[model samples]
Target: MAEDIEEHEEDTPTGRKKGLLIGLVLAVVLGGGGFYAAFSGLLPIGASATHAPAPSHNADEVAFVALDPLVISLGPDRGNRHLKFAAQLEVEPHATASVSHLKPRVLDVLNSYLRAVSINELEDPSSLIRLRAQMLRRIQIVTGEGQVRDLLVTEFVLN
Candidate 1:
């Protein structure tokens, strides 16, 4: 009976030690995995981290000039589809006057370019980026390089 008790006591301690070791290993593994996921941006909280805003090289020297909204009728066979585009031109604070002076030419270029686009092209989901680039290029050409910084498309509606 004494030998049986001794054996039982030994078994209990060894089993508890084994269980503790396994728990410690599990904790370590889980902790490491969580850290890795966070660091790698795989976790939702980590993934939500945003990039720091880019430092302004010109230091508040940027200005926006709102362009007149354009309403252009799509080409024939579209059955009265019209595209309304509203945008702003980003320019140097000092060049807002110069950029605004070219507004008529800018509007003319935009009108012609938009009119020339096929209805199908305007309907494509991926065409906005391309159209923006094209429009920016055209505006820069009219306003002269460096006079216009960027073209921000605020609204585009097709009906």
Candidate 2:
């Protein structure tokens, strides 16, 4: 009975702390080993993903065609608020001449669309993204598919 009691006393909270310390050390060592294995390319996952070079966007593959500046008149409620907008079209190097030939048509679409948009919509800061997308779609319709990659807005100001 005395031996059993001594055994129970030794098996209390003090022994639990030692087990917890060993577990924590093992977890840290294993975690570090796994990280080193992945980082050193011994493991198949992270090394290639982290160290691979990014694809470059060469200027030769794309070209920008600048549009003539546009000045749009805001209607009656806002007195003399003009939205001055300028943009460039990003297209394949081969498409520049064909796209530029259609500039008048593009301008007509932009002017008509901007004139139709409400003053509130023009004044909102975040509306540029929506506006840019809308303009790009209209431009693509006018220019045809695969001609325009993107529309880069160089200037947008309302005064």
Candidate 3:
């Protein structure tokens, strides 16, 4: 009976050790795969529906054009809410002229879109990300593909 008890204790520890080893190996492999995916951009950290990290550009080859700040009234449900937005368009240095020429159309598109949005949509914190994407798409359509690199929202205030 004493020999049987000793054998049981010895067997239990071996099984526990083997289980622990397998768990460790799985943890290492999963951790490595996560790192690989993140670094490879397969999993983008902090990316939003409307925003992504700008692609690399040579310093001398990029330019930014500021737009006039827009103050638009939100729909009446919120009792006199307003949005003040300011942003810049990034473009290739040579395309600055073209983008600048289209500035009026860009503002018109933004104004019309903002006015159409309800105060409730503007109130949600996540809405800014969606709004940014919508605005960027509209601006790009006006500016033509490849003319605008990115939209940098410098300020967004709701009052």
Candidate 4:
């Protein structure tokens, strides 16, 4: 009986090792296939569609009034970094002239506010949004309500 069992065991080479190798090969092939499919852009289901392209607006509906660039010195010692700020005001086509005339006052307000801001706040990445809102509010106040629509920051560099 024992000799018969030993002979049966040696007759076929099917065991855990063969099944494990087959499973591993199958997994690797499927994984590679999936990667290639996604990378080739053939799998549209996996593609992201979170945002849509911005629609074109009426060009003549709004106009931008550009302000002169300002270079504000930073730090009390005056040997430290300086801020170069440039921006434009979005207003109706008719308000452009009025906004342009008040450009000097706008620059003064912006320069004063920027100088008063701490260096740490200026360096923070998230602080830009808050800073923009504050600056916009100041600009609207200076230019009077309904004259300015938005404040678009074109350049903000600290060196």
Q: Candidate 3 on 1-159: residue-level lDDT in tens?
A: 999999999999999999999999999999999877876677744333335556878889889999999998875776778899899999878899989999999999999998898777887877787788898999999999999887889988899
Every model's TM-score = 0.63, 0.64, 0.65, 0.63
Q: Which ranges in model 1 have alpha carbons more than 4 Å from their true place?
A: 1-59
> What's model 4's TM-score?
0.63
Ranked candidates, highest TM-score first: 3, 2, 1, 4
* lDDT by residue (tens digit), candidate 4, 1-159: 999999888765666668889999999999999888876666743433222255465987889999899999997675688999999999878888999999999999999999999888999766787899899999999999999988889999989
Model 2, runs deviating above 4 Å:
1-56
lDDT of 2 at 120: 89
Higher-TM-score candidate of 1 and 3: 3
Q: Which candidate is the best by TM-score?
A: 3
Which residue pairs in model 4 clash with each other? none
Q: Which portions of model 4 miss their true places by more than 4 Å?
A: 1-57
- Which ten residues in a row are the worst by lDDT in model 2? 46-55
Per residue, candidate 2 scores C-alpha lDDT tens digits across 96-116 of 999999999999999999999
